[model samples]
Target: MKTARLCAGLMAVLVLTVSGCSAADQAQNPSPTSAAALTSCPATPLQAPAGNGQAPQGPPMNELKVPVDTSTSKVIDPAGAKQIQCGRTQLKTTDDVAYSTATLANGTAKPLHLDIQVPAGDSAKPLVVYVPGGGFSSANRKQTLNLRTFVAESGYVVASIEYRVQPDGATYADGLADIKAAVSYLRTNAATYGINPDKVALWGESAGGYLASMAGVTDTDPKSRVQAVIDKFGASDISKLMADYGPQIEQGFANSPNPIGQYITGSPAKSLAASPEAVTAANPVTHADAGDPPLLIFHGDNDRVISPSQTLLLHNAMTKAGATSTRYVVHGADHGDLAFIGDPNAVSPWSTEPVVSAMVDFLKATLS
Candidate 1:
């Protein structure tokens, strides 16, 4: 199952970073700190609406029932939850739409698709692209329908698009291409869907978070440029992985013959370690420009798959580069678990309420 693969591949990313990138010869795309990217952003960002979307307190199942932080957690979704419109116009979803197409490395044509949900009205709504994460190996556009429906209910047009995966030799660069293509498609056909092309944002989780972060920072092209970004527990810097998890990551690779590193980098294990070039290319921090859009980052303090330090690297880098960036560290939450909506186990009504609310708030603030 891709779920299992996503869960397992995330840990394997440490191995890939430890060994280095496959394309060691590529030149690093320098962060656009120059005068050209002068889109000044606010010094700070808005805080999450419900205090970082903390889980509700409950009695411990075993020794004692633990308490959820009621102040921070809001019950947006109740038991047997139905879609909530939040006192707005109703919404509708247009599923399985072919948004773009491209020729693959093997000369095969690949058609990309997206599922968009928007409020039913003539008014233009800001667009939010939902990028799924499966260690960049598996992508499920419908993974987080609750989040999508919730955002759409908040009067934003949300599109969940599929991108090329790492298993198919698609690197971060390729994935970004697919993402940009989707954005262009949406923008080109904005009126057809009643979309606000200028007000655009990207929201991604885990691997998708990484892509969104990259998309947030990359402004070389106007088609893919966005106004805001949301990264949920995605890794940012790979260069620091080796030092942070030296032995902790090595032992994880001992028994596994096919580690995720090779799959993502599109390189063999025996290949010489990648130089700083590949690392610079993959890390979103290296691409953070002064004109980068407002960014909201969330990471669990207890995330075992990708270290919290990873997100810290990105937030710090972007802040230093003159970008408006904010981060909320979720307490007692793990990667893509109870705190987020994409996971299958995230069925509890309150599980995603806080984060979804926070996300919608961020979008309203930035994309307005």
Candidate 2:
């Protein structure tokens, strides 16, 4: 009954949608319903199609799919770079890592890359999947090395992924969908990759961090898909940020890598639908349960992009739910400034070894 009512409400909205557009255009070219819209209403699980081919459960996956575009991609070969060997022993060498590609929610093929610092060996060592952040627009796979390197050196297999950027119609949800797909893909092909599907961990930075948190909090139907999550100074509530930090967001937009106008369109309802803060109800913190995997978070106190409160909120939520968790705040560090967190000679002075050390310890304790 609830599902039927939701579908009815959506139909009403769709009726009004046609009248708002040019009749001729509406007649000749219909505006297809977004997969998100078609699927269960807000706060519902994505369901497969029903008998009539009308997607009884929710939106059709095809509508939200993004195809891979190779022209705009760059693959950096870590050829001469140092490599770290894994499996309980930390060995650094100079070897190139291997990478492949995966399709996004929009059907777009994005690179699925990894640097195997630790060969999981015959033990099926726990795996950590890292997602890179770009505010849905900036950065790439390399910038996350500060954390990835630590995980690799700590005897675990690390899979770093690349996803579609926003403002290019790749909206925030697109990013989440892409990551989720990657997670599912990895789980399915774990044996081939020498990973233990049962002990997978999701890690992300900034926007990717927020997505990681969301995935951790939400159940993928059966309730045990993602085993754990780690967020790095990511905005959890998107709507809240837009409403509370409008001016700051506006400024960030001006400095964004892509045109703000394009990126803004991905979320038709703006903060209500895609903003990090707005989705807190579905946040890993709020949804955290005993069955959920543990959480580990790290953020700099001086972060101007995403305030420290975001980390605290998530931490408190997780803690309250009795989920094993940890929150680290570097006193003077800013976004991506882990490299400057402390002394320059200690292990990895520039890259916040202290924080990475904690993360490694956490993953080992929880995953192993």
Candidate 3:
């Protein structure tokens, strides 16, 4: 069972000042500045309404208010679909469909959980594995107005996944393996869900983004192979993350679950498999060859959690590797705020029309 706990903002500073990326270079891609990169963003971004579809009619010009500063540590009972609110935004799937869940092998008695939304008819639709972010400690597959809904409506069988947290430290490797397992499961069960496995896409946010990007980059295992990747503020290099997210080094490291550390063991001379970052150079971007699938990244210029540079670096790397890539850096949107941080919605004039529109267009062009 999942629980919801109100998290008070941890005033942990995560800043990593890299020497190579200059101010001009930073402006273009803004390398991950200290993991806890804080930039004073506008209260409201250039808003836009929900894309063409049936959407809620909320107050016009809804300003995203930063939650009150208070310590609300009580673990409230998790509610149904009506209660979880990632943000005020909503994704418009093509039809009303039933959802189901299952478990996978994560070396635990408890099976890894997965919640999937199948398309309306028996017609095969592409399957997209959705990964949520929480610094590796919190969050679940809640049906918030988050990206899951968008992926669903965009003609894909959406699966909201749950991976083990870092409390035990094997979560990263288990999580990646779980993603691969999920893909295998989807491919094996495609007929039942009316999904097309060949067109699979991995969409992840924050830490989940890292998982999704890794899956996209590494296709050695047929079961874990993903045809496309949608990384929302995910990191490719753990060393880069360690360098950038300063004070909260332990926390960031914990977030990754250090699969590299667990997978490889030997003397310091055995440098081939010591740390994730060390091996990350062979990651999606590192091993980016002309044949790899395209990647679509969504990030905010003012993101304080994950630097916009992460997104930029990824986009540049993808393009350089002959992979198609599209990056959208919302001017005023912050990390985890791209969903509803801005005023753009069905009701407001300042809604996120351009961003949402571009996202849909990109998904269609690539995923479709």
* Candidate 3: C-alpha RMSD after superposition: 15.5
Local distance difference test values of all predictions, in order:
0.63, 0.50, 0.50
Best by lDDT, which number?
1
Models 1 onward score TM values of 0.72, 0.60, 0.60
lDDT by residue (19-75, candidate 3, tens digit) is 011122112221244324322111212223447643323221112223211121111
**Of candidates 2 and 1, the better by lDDT:** 1
Cα deviation of 183, candidate 1, in Å: 0.2
User: Each model's number of backbone clashes?
Assistant: 9, 31, 22
Scored by TM-score, the top model is 1
Name the runs in model 3 displaced over 4 angstroms: 1-107, 143-146, 242-284, 338-351
